[model samples]
Target: MTASPALRPSAFTDAELIGSGRRVAEIEAQALQSLARRVDGSFAAACRLILASHGRVVCTGMGKSGHVARKIAATLASTGTPAFYVHPGEAGHGDLGMITDKDVVLALSYSGESDEVLMLLPVFKRQGNAIVAVTGRAQSTLAREADVHLDVSVEVEACPLDLAPTSSTTASLAMGDALAVALLEARGFTADDFARSHPAGSLGRRLLLHITDVMHAGEDVPQVSEEATVSEALVEMSRKRLGMTAVVDAQGRLSGLFTDGDLRRMLDDTVLDLRNTRIGTLMTRNPKTIDARQLATEAARLMETHKISGLIVVDEERRPVGALNIHDLLRARVV
Candidate 1:
């Protein structure tokens, strides 16, 4: 006889499901809290070993632990500690050559007895590299052989089956994060250093992009003499399409600036003799300016705060060197 259709489990009420999730969250939080309390001299020792290493930290593990190792290596590398992930299985074949006397090895195993990981100890030792073991069992061979042993033991797995790694992996990842932050703080790593490492990132663009890099130079910069007529200055502004023109003296030093706003005020006041009116008479003299070497973001902030759309880039002697507008900043991604 054929079996009847299997009955689905009874649906849980929303309240009951919420309570179950809350309990799991509380239990996992407590587990992490307990793990934090266990950190002591061993954690410090591991940091010291990694900090002293002249070469990159080579991280290794198997299966689930292997995923955690890759993340830990990336975190370390991004936070001033040079590190790379090397699969233990691959290391046993030929990748062991990546480990050098100047490097430190971090091996992870939840059971503390992964055969593939264990096979790498002899090669690491022979290469004269220091080992830091992250495992749940302090008495395990991997932990016992390590120069510094970090205990990542958890009271229980979050998995209901008690087979898949859950709380244990969380503890290991948190511990790895802690190690990376501690090393970063101890090294006094600065934002500029981080920007150098991540030049293509947003922070790098904000901190490293200079005004000279994006400003228009030479003839592209709108300029007129102090004696030039208002009509001539207006023509120059239109030709350059910069919305303003720098007014300079015979010595080439900036005397003033005539902008679209100034022209509007002049026309509103019924100044009809544009050909007879000198640009210096209608210009804003000695306007706020910036050095060519200043960061583009700083210039953007200055413009934003002053409610201006453009700025004249100047040299040490206040001579017009370059010019930039809001469009330049937007194109450079400094806005």
Candidate 2:
């Protein structure tokens, strides 16, 4: 007989479902709080072992622990500690050759008895490599065999049946972050160091992109001689579409800036004649400028602070070399 499409007998109510989620979060939070207190001398020893190693940290684990191991490896590498993940299940199938004697092994196993991980311990021992184990069972075989063991044991699981690895995995991840952060502090890692590794992200663009990289150079920069009439400056600004034009002297040195705002104020004077007035007469003198080598994000800040939408790139001698507007920064995703 076919079954009816009615609700299951034990389905949860809306309030009960939300309460279960809340319980899980509270349990995981408490687990992390406990894990923090357990980060003792062994944690320091783990950092020491990794810092002393000349080779990369080879992190390994099975199942869910493997996921956390991979993330930890990435964090360490991004924070100036060279590291990578080597899955234990694949290690037995010839991936073990990827690890060298100089490298340190950071293994994660909540039970501390993952057969795939434990199986590789003898090989690491034979190579004389240091092993850092993060496990819940302090007296488990893998923990006992490791050079240093970090305890991430939690008294309870967030799962209703207490069989899933909810709290245990959370504790393990927290321990991994603790290790990465400690190593980061010890190595004196900087944002530039981090940006070099994360060059594809928004943070990298903010740190690595400079004014020269985004500014329009050469003939592309809208500018006119200071002696040029306002009508001529308008032609240059219209041709470049930068909403502004620079006023430079005969030597090509920036004398002042004339933008759409200045044009508006000039037009407010009913007697003023655009055809007869020189751009220098209506220009904003010594307008805000930036060095080409300065960060693009700095330009965003300068424009925001001055309530302007554009800036002129200048050399050491105050010559207008290039120009940029909020549109350029927007196109580059710096804004």
| lDDT winner | 2
Candidate 1 lDDT trough over 10 residues, lowest sum: 1-10
TM-score result, candidate 1: 0.78
For model 1, the stretches where C-alpha displacement exceeds 4 angstroms are 1-40, 137-139, 153-167, 199-204, 225-227, 249-251, 255-257, 261-273, 281-288
Local accuracy of candidate 2 as per-residue lDDT tens digits, 1-335: 65675644667799998998999999999999998898898999999999999999999999999999999898888888899999999999999899999999999999999999999999999998899999999999989999999999999999978898899989988888888889888988877788899899798899889998999999999999988998999999999999999889999999999999888876787567778888888899989999999999999999999999899999988899999999999999999
Q: What local lDDT score does residue 101 receive in model 2, on the 0 to 100 scale?
A: 97
lDDT of 2: 0.92
Encode model 1's per-residue lDDT on 117-170: one tens digit a residue: 999899889889999999999999999999999999999887767788988998
Candidate 2 TM-score, C-alpha based: 0.88
Clashes in predicted model 2: 0
Tell me the lDDT of model 2 at 63: 92
